[model samples]
Target: MARAHRYTVEVTWTGNTGTGTSGYRDFSRDHEVRGDGKPVLPGSSDPAFRGDPGRYNPEELLVAALSQCHLLWFLHLAATAGVVVTGYTDRPEGTMTENADGAGEFTEVVLRPAVTVADPGMVDAVPGLHERAHQMCFIARSVNFPVHHQPSTSAADSAV
Candidate 1:
C-alpha cells in the first residue's frame, strides 16, 4: 500500500503600501512564504509583472523543484548501482506561454546535469541512470508538461 504525505505552507502578502490594491500600480507583489521548521522564503511575481527582481518567483521555484527531485533520485540510484558520484550540478530551464488573458502554462522543462564519477568505467552508465531518475522523479511525474534530460558525465580526476 502507498503512504500519503502532506506539505503545508503559509503565504502572507507584505505589499500593502498604505493602501491595499487601490490601483494597478499602488501595491507591491512582495510576499513571504513560511513552512514548519524552514526559513522564510521571499517571494514575488516575475519582474515582468512589476515585481522585485531580487525575490524568488513561482516559475523559477517550479523549475528548481523539478531539478532538485531529479538530482536526489539520480544520486540514490547511482549509490544503489555502485557508481560512486563525486560531484553533480544542474542548470535547468523551463518555458512558459502566456495567453491573451494573462494566464500562462509551462510548455516544457529541460534538465542539464553535469556529473562526475569516481571511476572511468562508470561514465557510460550515467546516462541510463539519468533516464531512470527522470522516470522516478515525483515532480516530473506530476507535471503536465514534458521534462527532458541532457546529461554529461566525466571521471573524477578529469572533471573540470
Candidate 2:
C-alpha cells in the first residue's frame, strides 16, 4: 500500500521599500516563513546576494533540513537496534556553484555528525548507521546532488 503526505508553508515578503524593486538593490531580501502552530521563520537570500547576514537563508535552511532529517531517522534506527544513543550533533556543509548568468545549484552537501552512545560496544556500529540514515532521510533522498557523510562517535563516558 502507498500513502501520501503533504507539507505546506507560507512565505511573506517584507522587503518592500518606498519603491519596490525599482532598482537592482532597492529592496531587502527579507521574508517570513510560517507553518500552522509553528513560530514564524525569518528568511532571506544568501548574504552573497545582498542579503542580511544575520538572517536565515534558503541555502542554510536546506542544509539544516538535511541535518535534522538524518538525525531524526538515525535516532529512530538506533532505538530499534538498541544502540542507546545519548547525544548527537552535526555540522553540515554545502557547495553551491553559480554561473556567470546568475544561475546556481548546489553541487554537494557533507553531513559531519558526531554521536555519543551509552555503550562503547555500539561505537563500531555507529559508522554504518549513516548509510542507513541516508537511505531513509527524506531530505537526503529528495536532493538532486549527492549527500556525503562523515561520522564520529564515542561512548558517553569518553571524550571525542
Candidate 3:
C-alpha cells in the first residue's frame, strides 16, 4: 500500500486597494502565503500579469521548489555514500511557454548545481549522483515537465 502525506497553506489576498477586482487592471496581485509556525511568504503573480516585480511569483516558486527538492536529496545521497560534500550551490532555470489564449506550461527546468567535495576521490561520484537524486526528489517527480541537471564538481585536492 502507498503512504500518504498532507500539506497545507493559507493564501490571503492583500491588494484590495479599496476596490476588489472591480476591473481587470484595478486590483493588485499581491498576497501572502502562510503555514503554521513558518514565516509568511510574500507572493504575487508574474509582473507580466500586473503583479509586483519585487515579490515572489508562483512561477519562480515552482522552480525554486524543484531546485530545493533536488538539493536536499543530493545532500542526503552524498552523505550516505561518503562523498563528503563540503559545499553546494544551484542556479536552476525554467522555461514556461504561454499560448495565445493565455494558458501556460513550463516546458522544462534545468538544475545546474556546483558541488564541492572534501577529498579528490569523492569528486568522481558527484556528477553521477544528480540523476539518482532527481529520481528520488518528490517535487521533481511530481512535476509534469522534464527536470534535467547539469552539475559541476570540485575537489579539495590542491592539484587542481
Candidate 4:
C-alpha cells in the first residue's frame, strides 16, 4: 500500500470500404501486444491476430489480479497466525452480465473464487483467513463488486 501506478490504454480504429461493401476496423492497446504478429481479434477477418488469449482480455486480467492478491494475503495471514500452510490454489470464475441500468453497457462483475488450502492444522482457519484476506487484499478493496470466496480445506476442521 505504499504507492500505486495508473495506466491508460487507448483503442482506436478506422475503416474505408465501398458504400455497399462491408468495412472492418482494427484495435490496439496503447502499446502493441507481443505475439506472432499484430494483435487482433480472431473473430475478425484479420488472420494476423495472434496475440495470447489471456493477455488481450482486460476482464480476464482483472479476475486474475484479484484472485492472486487474495491468495497472497491469505498466505501472509495464515503464516502470522501460526498456521502451517503447505500450499494453496484458487480458481476464480468471473461472470459478466449486462448492466442493469439499461444503458446498453455491462455492469458489476461477480467473482466466485474457490480456494483450496493445504495444511494439517489450517482447516479451521479457512473462514477467518478468507475474511482477513478479503480485508487485506488491495485488489478486492479497490473494486466495488461482490467478490465471493468459497474456501475449502483438505484437513478436518478439528485439526486446527
Query: Largest lDDT belongs to which candidate?
Result: 1
How do the candidates rank by lDDT, highest first? 1, 2, 3, 4
TM-score per candidate: 0.96, 0.97, 0.95, 0.59
Q: What TM-score would candidate 2 get against the native?
A: 0.97
Q: Model 3 reaches what TM-score against the true structure?
A: 0.95
Better of 1 and 2 by lDDT: 1
Clashes of each: 0, 0, 0, 0
Which pairs clash in model 1? none
Candidate 4, residues 63-121, lDDT tens digits: the string is 78888898788889888987767656667777665455723322344434444445555
Q: How accurate is candidate 1 locally (lDDT)?
A: 0.95
Q: How close is each model in CA RMSD to the real structure?
A: 1.3, 1.1, 1.5, 7.1
Which of 3 and 4 is the better model by TM-score? 3
Candidate 1, residues 1-160: lDDT per residue as tens digits? 9999998999999999999999989999999999999999999999999999999999999999999999999999999999999999999999999999999999999999999999998988898899999999999999999999888888957743
Stretches off by above 4 angstroms in model 4 are 1-54, 99-119, 156-160
lDDT for model 2:
0.92
In order, candidate lDDTs are 0.95, 0.92, 0.91, 0.59
